[model samples]
Target: MPLPDLLVSAIALVRDRRVLMVTARGRDVHYMPGGKIDPGETAAQAAAREAFEEIALDLDPDDLVELFEVVTQAHGEPDGRLVRMRVFRAETDASPSASAEVGALHWVTTADLDRCPPAGAEVLRRLAASGTID
Candidate 1:
């Protein structure tokens, strides 16, 4: 069965090459600071909301970078479902700190991308190729 819901995520790039990432308090992997879009919210709205929740950064709805949607091949689901991710880019007022759902925070550059989660690696690739990300 396919996953019922899609994930909408946003990448807030800073200093050209570094982007914001969050690690949930108990989680081991670093991921972009966005999350699931609630039933009534648009993908862009959800991206901004999640960014604020996870990183304590205030993202104006207008500031996010509009990138292509990503249809990620099934990787983690035992049921073999693809993940539809809507990724965006934007510059932030400042680097966000871990808060609420987040337990750790880091600013990652292309050089350090290999250490990030697979999804993040994909994002970096798209960013570098399209010039929307650093």
Candidate 2:
């Protein structure tokens, strides 16, 4: 049988020296502020929706700058599953707070990557390499 398809859209809302991260309820690994792409929704649309749903921050789809697209083993999911991630950078001055499925929210830097999931760590590493974050 084919592997279960898992497609997600995430956002890195960077400001100052930190990027926004969220921990799902009952989960320890923090991830970028976004979630799965719903049927009929564009990846950018999903990214914006997930950001607002999880962090209570409304982000315009047009304001999101596409950053990276990576396919990797799914984290916290069944074996043999894969995740296709479309990561974006949203420009906003709004503060993020825990909401919806988010249990805790944090603004993290490169030093805090140990607490992040693998995909999230990859995102941060790329951002740092691109000089987008310190």
Residue 75 lDDT, candidate 2, scale 0-100: 83
Best by TM-score: 2
Candidate that would win on lDDT: 2
Off by over 4 Å in 1: 131-134
Give the CA lDDT, 0 to 100, for residue 16 in model 2. 81
lDDT of 2 at 64: 90
TM per model?
0.82, 0.92
Q: Write the per-residue lDDT of candidate 2 for residues 1-134, one digit (tens) a residue.
A: 86877899999888887788888899888889888999999999999999888898899998898998867778877777888889998888777789968999887888988997778888888888888888
Q: Which RMSD does model 1 reach against the true structure?
A: 2.3
lDDT tens per residue, model 1, 90-134: 665575778877888877766667666566767777777866446
Give per-residue lDDT, candidate 1, residue 63.
Answer: 73
- What is the Cα root-mean-square deviation between model 2 and the actual structure? 1.4
Cand. 1 TM to true fold: 0.82
